[model samples]
Structures are given as C-alpha cells and as structure tokens.
Target: MARGISLNRRTFLISTSGAAAGVAATGLAGTGAHAQDGALPEYAAWKDPDALIVHTDRTLETRREAIGAPPITPARELFVRNNLPTPPLSATDDPDVWEIAFEGVASPATMTLGELKRYGVTSTPAVLQCSGNGRAFFDHEASGTQWSVGAAGNVVWTGVPLARVVEAMGGAAAEARFLTGTGGEDLPPGIDPLTILVERSVPIEALDDALLAYEMNGEPLPIAHGGPVRLVVPGYFGVNNVKYVRRIALTPAESEAKIQRTSYRIRPVGVEGDPSQPSMWTMTVKSWITAPLHEPSSGAVVIQGVAMGGASALSSVEVSTDGGETWQAAELTGPDMGRFAWRPFALVTTLEPGRYTVASRATNADGDEQPRDFDPNERGYGHNGWDAHAVELTVS
Candidate 1:
C-alpha cells in the first residue's frame, strides 16, 4: 500500500509573523485591525491570529497587508473559508487512513490514501480564491461573507492526478458528462446530510487538470485546510475545489445537492435561486495593491500588488494612480508560477504630493480584461471590477 503523500517547495516569499494593526486613516489605509475576536471555534486559530480578520466562525479573512507581495500565500496567513464546521482534529490524525470512492468508471472502486499515492504524483500552483472575494465592493448587501481581496491565495497543491485515478479505475464511463465531488465534513445530526452537503459538479473536461490533493503549499494539508484528501480543480473558483472530498463520481448530469441546485449560483438581484442561474465556476481577472497601502512616506512610492488571469495565463497588468481614468502598464515580477497561479506586479512611479485613487486591471491570454464595474448579482459573487476595487492614497 502506498501512503500517498508528496510535497515540493520553491520558496519565493519569506514568512512574515504579521504586520502592525491600526494603519493610519490619514494616509493610504482602509481597515485598521488584524484580529477580530469572533465566536468561532479553535479550528480557526490554526492560522496566525494576527494575520486574519475574523468575519465569522467558519470564515477568516487575511489582512490585505499580510497577503504581502508573495505570489504564494503562506499557509499561516492564508484565509480560511470552510463551507461547514471544521471536522474534529482527531479524525484527521492519520493521513493514510483517509479513503476515496470512485464511481461511474469501468471498474468502480474505493482506495485508501495509502493505496492511491502509488499511482504517481504531480504538483500545480493555482490561484485558490473564493468566488466571493470582492464581495465588500458590491453595492448590494451580499448574502454570505463580505470578503475583500484577502479571501484568496496562490497555493501549490501536490496530489495524484484525477486522470491517474480514472486509469486505475478502468477509465470513466462513456456517458459521463459531469465530474462530481462530495465533501466528507461531518454534518449536524437530526437532519438530512444531502440538504446541507458540499458537493459540486463540474464539466468532465475539468478532470484533465484535477487532482486528489493531500498537500498544500508543500506541507501536510492542515485539517482546517482539508487534511486527509481534498479535490483540487485548478482554474476554478475556490468553492469548486471541494475540500475533504471523500467521494468522486462521474455522472451524466450535475449533482442534485442543494448547494449545487441553489447555493453559490449567480443571479440577478432580488431573484431566487433556480437551475437556470449561472453557477460560480472559473474565476475572473482581478488585482489589488498590497504595498504602499499602509502609510508610506512621501517621495518615490513604488506600488506593488498581485494579479491573476482567472482560468487563463496572465498576459498584462496595468496600474492607474488616477483611478480608472488613466492607466499605465505595470511590470510583472517574480517567477511565473504557471497559468493557474498569480503573478506579482509593480508600478514604479512617483506620485505628486496629493490624494489619489489607485487601481489595477489585469488581462488574460483568453482576452478576459478586468472591468471597471462588475455586474450586479444576487449573492455578490465574483466582484472583480477594477474601479470599485480602487484604493485611496493620501501622499504628502
């Protein structure tokens, strides 16, 4: 039996303990606090307490400053957004004890983590971002967490490729059109688990780059971050990643789980969720200034930030000190982690001593450009408009 676990690292960013809270309101600063004492359980504390803003018991938002200039977000500073309560740590004490069941294959079978890792391994750097990352910028009162840009990160996942798993299972069925993943989180008793289940179904083509991940950011996937075995679907929204994925089935149609049939669907404001609404799938182009965000001294202000091309490769990033009216091409810096990962960008220019609004727009190989205004949606999902994300810079 192969206790399947392989992790690799190319250290590009140093781990910072955390930044000082209370950024001056007189200058370029927004939210001031690093930690907000919420009633969430200890599972939320696995991350650096000083590096996150507690939005809810199950949701923790990383501080924009703590996100830093690194393309790979440190696990300690990475945002935490569990669709359900974190399962007890004891259940995840042994990684090899985990198991996964495969269906809709020529030979349907179940395999323990130990047996699965023998198939071969691979790693991929991807933009692991929530579908509601920029929900705070939305004009409407969003339904879920009001996450800003902090609810995202660039993470390298190590796991057995879904293709290998399919091959081991004797290949998928001819009629399979959807790849569905079911989360293994323990649900509340006295209720139907399917009612609140976290199961997602994506196009069968997505399996080309999918993986049964057991490691995140070159470390044992933390229980809070989905320890035993999670499904990593690169180039898709975070919700589609399906943490704690214990069951994967290739089916003819999408999962009928309430989450899929109703929740996370993008619809017009005031409209109720139905089958016709667009599901939050792949991400859109987005970028936000990370440095010079705290009060910066006058003179040479080198603005820096991170940008992602969503489902495609990032082609270019442009900065605008005067909001969206004027734009200038910004230099893409650091290692190109791949099409699924984000690229760090910097704009070197001195701003005149005055108040200014700063923003960044990103374009992808697919020609998907970040818009100045995001269309209104019922849940405020995927708000990547550049103008609404603009930051105010007060330079002396």
Candidate 2:
C-alpha cells in the first residue's frame, strides 16, 4: 500500500495517503544512542542513538545492519558528517528567517528562507554518500574517518528548484561556469579562512538538478542534517550538498575555497593535493550486503543488500555467493525511485551448512560497473571494489 503511493506520484517521498495507510511514524528496530553523561546532542531527538556509531560530536556513522530493507531510508537512520563543527541552534533559532545571498546573476540579492519557498516545492530521491564511504577497505590508511559501508543513505529532499531561483534572479551570468555553495558552519579562530571554510563548487551543469532543500523524508530537515536550508545536487558526493547553505554563487570559475582547491581531490597515495587533481565531485557505482552479520540458520537464507548507480540510473544488481566466481541476478524490490536513488535488493536461495563469502555488484545505466579492486588513492575516496566490500558469513 505504501509502495502504491510512491509509485503513483514522484512529487513526494511518501504521500499523505501512505500515512493514512498506517506507515507514517518511524518505528526503528535499530538501536538509539544517548550520551554516557546524560546529555543529548542535536540529533538525539530524531536519531536512533544505538544504531549509530559515534566517531565524534561532528561525525556519526550508521550501522550497516541498521540500514534494514527500506527503499527509502528513515531520517533517523541517516549518517552525519560535518566538515568543521556544527554551529549552535541560537544562530538558526528562526529557521524560516534564515538569510541567503545570491550572486553572479543579473540581479544579485539576499533572500530569506521564507522568500525562497515561494518559488515552488519539489522532491527527488538521491543517495547522500560520503566520498570516503568505503575508506576502511583501503590498505593505505586514509586520512579521514574510516567508514565501512554505512556512510550513505537514500533519502528524499523537498525544496525550491535551483533553476527556477536562478531564472527569477534574471538567470545566471553568461560567463558563469560553476555553481558554488558556502555552508554556514562556524569557522574556527586562528585558522586561515581559505583553508577551513566549508565551501564547495561544482560544474555549471549540476545547476540543472540542484535544489535549495528545506525538507527531508516528508519531515522538516533536522539541524544536524542541514536544517534551515541545504544545497542538494543529485548524483554528486555528499560534500557538494552544503548544509545550512548561506550563499549560492554562479562564478566564471570554481570557487577558490580550500575544499575546492587542495582538499577533497583524488590523487595518488603519495602525491600532494593540488588544483590539477580531479575533485571528488560525483560518486561511482557501488553496492554492499547488509545482512547475515553472524551465522544464519541452517536452511533457506535470504541475502539482502542495497545497490546504487552513482551518477546514473542503476541498470541491474548481481549477487554472488562464492565471491566473484559465480553470479546471479538479484531482484530489486520496492518502487523505483529514479536515477539517483539506491535500490534495495534480495536473493533467496537454499544454502547448506558451510562458510561462504557473499558479494554484490552494481551496474549503472551508463554501463559503468563495480570493479574487483579499487585503485588506492590519497584520501581513499570512492572505493567501490566488490572484492574488498564483500561480506563473509557462516551458515550452520
């Protein structure tokens, strides 16, 4: 019944009809987290504290098992990655009154959150994944958080269409070649702003599907997940989706922010980062198993997991019980959520009592498929190697 609502209309993630069908409130089977010291962080109210592995006050990772079998991940089960530190609520006490500056258009102006909402509201499903999502699989000891496979989730975002905003502002400048967004996180003192500022720039083509998102998964966007407003660029890496976005600039060239210049670039393990290196802009084809963490019962065991087409629509998902030696097509269930969303898949087959390695491979509509070994990079970004991401399980 819930699937019918989403299938009938692509406007919202789950329509009011779905709620009427008794699928409204979140009933997470996953664990929730609480601070050992009796303090609750900004995400405490909406997040499952136990389902998340806290790396720090600024970084939280979702447990793979907690991902469950949902086509659209619950807001409470999403991962959180803050570049610097999340600013206080006092700054955004009146979320609707938050201001944003628009530049490089014919008529540059600063508009409040409420003003932008007048343009129109639309929703789309996309994978919000960290560039270093599969970093732990690398042997190079990546510099950032060592994520396994849970630093990503498929969620629906509702917001004003970026193109419409640009048009209302008299369209982008003819010289504009990039779309840059500046986040509202508080900058640390004593550090060069250029080096630590949370700003990112993507190609101008991205403006076509971008959004000044104010909602997530049919609920108000949480502060911990970029509340007042955010820049949602479909098919791009999470870093490009700036949180608490304060500025949208159409520039002749990419912003000179540190994140766009020297950081978040893909380079050789020993190489120094420079503007010439390719930035971690778009994601790559990826998928992973999310079940059977321990021994499964001796009988028919169903293998379940999620797969996504990074920059294109997913074409198919293949499952292999014996590593990559053999493969079988897995059935993708749930309503199709378009190009940028991840699909939940499952394969049910009888397995005798024995140890087995399980792996899943994803192919995108563009014909890009997962590789067996991901190349080692400086920051361990975009590691989608099926062999390295495989899971081992013992059935008894």
Candidate 3:
C-alpha cells in the first residue's frame, strides 16, 4: 500500500545538497527558524495548541480555537497538507538564488528567483482548501486524511504572475494545453520513482491568474506551508497549488504523474479501469459552523462559521437549527475578499431545551446552492453534500 512519509522536527534532516549548503551557511537545521534568522519561529513551537495532527506530524488541521480566525489565516493557525516529507527550511533561505527550470516552450529557460521578481508582484485574497475537506463525513471512509471542516484556510498571497514567467520563457506553443509544476519534496525510500511524483498540471489558461507566491499573509512563506515559492491557483482546489515549486513545463498533454492520472480524480462509486474519471479542479460551495462547538444551553444562542462559493461570489448562507427541514438566512459578515475567498457568516436564535441538528448551506452568486445529499465518489475527492456538514447538538 502507498503511504505518506512522516517527518518531525527532530527526524527531518537537510538531505539534498542544495539544502545542505543553505543549512551550512545559516545553521537553520532543526532550529525551526525561517530563512532570515528569526523572521518566523519554528513550525512546532508556533502553531496553535488546538491544532490536530491529522497525519503523522506533518499535516495539521484547525480546531475550534482557530475556527473564527481572521480573513487572513495566521501562519500558526493555517492548516497544512503535504504530498511528501516537508522540505527543509534551508532549501529556501535565499529566495534570490532560487532557480526554476522551464521546459517545453519555444525557448526553454531557467529563471532565477531574483529575475522572476522583476516582473513585479501582486497580492490577492483566496481560499486554499484540500479537495477532501469533508471526506471524514462520507459513509464509506476515504483512504487518506479524514478531514472534517478544518482542512481549509483563506489568505492573501503575494507573488509574481505565472503568466509573466511563461512569457519570459518565450511563450508556449499553440498545442501546449497544460502547465505542469514540480515541487522539491523527496520521495520515501523504496517508492518507485516511476509510480508517482509530487507534480500536477492545470489548464494552460489558468496561468494568467496563477501566482508563484513567496509571501503569504504578510510574512515570508514558511516551509510548513509552501515557502520560498509555491504556486497559488485562485478558485481552484489546494492540490492545484504546488508547494516548493521548482519546475514549470508547458505540455502538449496533461501530466501523467500519479497524482494527476490516478489520485485526485473523482469517479463513480466502485468505478474501475485506469483514467476512470475527471480530475477535480474548482471546489464546490460549502459552509461550516465554527462557533458554539456544541449545543448551547437553552435560551438564546449565537452560531457562526465560514462559507466559500468556489468560482463565484457567495450570494447567501442559510442556517438550519432543526436538520434540513427548515433553514433561515444567516447574516454574512466580513468584507468581500473576492470571488475566491471564504466569507464569514453568523446566525442567532433562541432555542428551547432539546436535541437538534444544526447545519449551514452556502449559495453562490450563480444560483448553485449546497445539495442536501451529494452522492459518494470512489476516492471521496469532493464531498460537499450539506448533510455531511450537519452537527448533532443536545441542549440540557
């Protein structure tokens, strides 16, 4: 069985020559200190105490303590997802020297991090959500992380446009249909190199809106997330945003990488055959109740949470205090961060002592509302069914 490799602060070492050189110069190995001496503290020490380790020490999920966090998720409160062992911070100590190799263009090129910055920088607020955010709620368990509602975050990313880099590489051929990105993460021992790679591809058209971000939420990107340089695809699932990005390739065909062809794709339940389904791209509309973790004692109770509209702006959010039998409009809070960012919503109501099922549903400007029941897919890639997010609460 394929497994995710786990690495802790103590067990993780700078194994690559490029990283070793950076570590030798700065002594950052295992120190948890980011590139510029003490700009950011170590990952283990800075994250919220309520953060849950979803996968070996590498992946973390936000808990109630971080549910109502600001529009821009703090570095410490941001959730984490890794396809491979976390790259050592030393690998990104000097953004100036980092190089990204490009191929399959009219003029294959290699651009230095410094040169890449010459295109100028832009910032945009967006949500990065794992495709499997609600997999845990599936009646049939998914094979990977069983995330609930905490496997997502909204943040403002700062970086150069990916289109700029593509332009610098002499543009793409008309036949190039996909833009593939490769990360610096290492594969576990004994894993067949041919079987998989930490790489994924997006439609070439997406390059115009994508960003190669070096700064997230006003701080230098941290290794825990994708630091030094990570690809940010606004309005797309987190898997499309590659971390520790080191290569960009214009391809005539989509990536044959395992992550692209086999994993991350949504297929009918019990589907069989290779290349069985389409890959997941844009996220589905979804909402979650963050505050009042449990049923509040009788009388008046206030409930709050977040809603995301995927590719469209959120039109409204409705809360149901009694299962899906009835739902009332909830007050949407926070500034309009943009079409791709999550919006905060709240609802207050007086409840009588009893058992209740509390749930929320988000509707996008395009008139797509959350569904009461989303049929299960084989891999559980996108489980946005409203019933999956309902919580059971009992008031004394």
Candidate 4:
C-alpha cells in the first residue's frame, strides 16, 4: 500500500455554487456532457505518434481486470513504459560476465550482480509512473512517448537498499549531491534489448529510499521488464527508474542526462491560467474514474478509481454530474501510501436515461484541487490536475 493515497493540497479553485445553477439533475443532463458506452473508449487526440496519452478516459490502449488481494497488480496486468524495445539477452550469460561499475565518486568500484546480492538486500512494493502521464492534453504539443494513463503500474520490488550499497562504498562523498545509473548500452536500431536499456539518475538524498530491485511482483524479474537489476525510485516518474542497470555513480550536481535534462518537469502551480508563462516546479492534485466508464445504461453504477499527490496526501474526492456546477464527495480508501501513488476509491449512484460525462477531481489535505484545464506547455511533461477524460455515455 506504499503507493496508495491522495494529494496534500488543492490544485485549482472554482465557484462551485455559481456553476451549479441551471444544471439539470439526475446525472449530467444539462451540463452539455454525454455518457460513454461500456466498451473501452478510443482516444480523441492521437495525432502525435510519439506520445501515448493514458487517462481514466474511455480510449484505453490497454486495461486488464483488477487482480489479487493486497492487490499486487499482476505482471501481465502491470503497465509498461519503455523508451526502448525489450532486449534479447542470453540467460546463460555468467553472472561474472555482467559487471556494474560505480563512477563519478571519489573512489569508484565495480562488482557483478551476484556479489551485490550477497550483501543481503531486501525489496518492497512501490508504484512507478510516467512523468508525462497526461501529456496528451498539452495544447502546443510535445515530442516523445505520448503515454495515456496506462503507462504506469505498481510492483513488488525486491532489491538492495541503494543506501546500503552506497554506504558500503565508503559512504557518500561530501561533494556528491546526485546518483546516476547507466543501464547496459543501447543496441543498434533493430537489435532489441529484452529489458529497458538506458541511463537515469536522482538526487543523492533520494538514494536512502531507492532500491536496486531484482524481483518484481513476488517473482523473479521477467525479461520483458527490467531483470537482473533495475533502479526503483518511489514517487517520481518511471523515467527515473532505469532498467537493466549496469553502473551507478555519485555526482556533484543534478544529472543533465537525456531523460533528466530534456524531460520530466511541470510548470509552476499558478500557471494553470496561463501555461505559456514560465514558473517553478509543482505537481497538481489529480484523480481518474476507472469504473462505470462511458455511457452507462440507466440503473446502479459503481464509480471507482484512484488519486495521487506530489507534495501532499489526498484530502477528499468530489464528483460533478453537471460539469463543474455541482459536487458530491466520494469515499477514499487506503490513504496510508503517503500520496505519491494512487489509492482506489468508489462512489455508487443511479444513472438516468441520457448521455453523461463522468469526472473525478481530488483535493489534497492542503486544499489544492485538480484544475478543469491547464494552459498548454511545450514539453507536456507533468499534466496532472486538469479535468481527466470525459467519457460520453448513453444511459438508455
């Protein structure tokens, strides 16, 4: 449950009472919204081939039935985000043949995967998300993987605490403020790397909670995923979790690597009104409705899904049947994960015979709520807080 919770503050503010006026009752009638069919919906803006946008919206590229108790999402059900194709490596390769070198530190060292495991490390379940999760909404448009909502997932990771390994290497150097991990080299254009092959890093302080996870979801790492070894950074986007890791190092400044320097950033919170304006970094409160999606037929429907926060734990979840006019509170479940990832939720209601657009907005304990829409940005890295997918449903 480490990845379950809500945002800590409100991401936006609206005059609920004013918007509610003149709105028809019994489920989004006069709100100018429509309902989506029970079938998985297709995306409206898939013009960009590089980016894949995934929201709780109806156009889901992939969605499997929820599985397991304590509910560790199954490996097959677990989502995937790979900048590169799955690699093809021989299983018989000797552990000694694989080497992990430490660089950028005062006294760097290199060791094989077997040697590191002998140090007695452990693992935990954590959620990994793509920083560009809701990128499809960027008004100006950006390049790179345009992932929808399904690009993220939770896994039970088994690995050595990065701190343990770093400390063993004569503790961290005083000048070191960041840790960089380089996975195996990227192969030629056509050669597939069964695992994700890339380099990524994080702040040195974050190492205390980072992991060198070798196992995922209660099983040995699969080749499709990062096996042998991978970097597991909780809370941050999946880009930071470098797969097929081969080397790590301590650095004096923030990493300016491809993934870090060119990607994964959010406009300041106040920029929602004007996305073109420059601002500081801040992740907004956001949530998505997973069930009763599309135009649900008339009768009882269970509204359920999850929400997350960047700096705050989620405080409340609200639903608006008539656009943003009216709001009703939904039940929150498992707020123990501390808001980095989403915790499931539900809201039961009866639908009328009509098309409706269902949306879920979450607020952090700090009073920040999700925005109806955010100003367009160039990169479209952090697109949280905006009104997620509007599933058109026919309640006949």
Tens digit of per-residue lDDT, candidate 3, span 270-333: 7752555778888878887776654479988888888989878888999988777799999988
Tens digits of per-residue lDDT for model 1, 18-93? 2222122111133213223332347645677677656656677777778878878899888888888767787578
Shift of residue 293 alpha carbon in model 3, Å: 1.5
lDDT of 4 by residue, 166-198 (tens): 777777788887777776645666743322246
Best by lDDT: 2
Q: For model 2, how does the per-residue alpha-carbon lDDT over 1-396 read when each residue is reduced to its tens digit?
A: 222122212211111112111111111112223222222356444687656655445556677677867899888878888887676766546778989999999999999989999999999999999998877667766777666677899999999999999999999999999999999988878988888888999999999999999999998787888887899999999999999999999999888888899889999999988999999899889898887666898788889989999989999999988878899999998578999999999999888899777889999999999997788999989988887777776799
C-alpha displacement of 63 in model 4, angstroms? 3.4
In terms of lDDT, the poorest run of 10 residues in model 1 is 1-10
Global Cα lDDT for candidate 2? 0.80
Computed on alpha carbons, the lDDT of every model, listed in order, comes to 0.79, 0.80, 0.73, 0.55
Task: Tell me, by TM-score, which candidate is best.
Answer: 1
Q: Would you estimate the TM-scores of all the predictions? A: 0.90, 0.89, 0.85, 0.71
Question: lDDT of model 2 at residue 82?
Answer: 80
Using TM-score as the yardstick, the better of models 1 and 3 is 1
Candidates 2 and 4 compared by lDDT, better number: 2
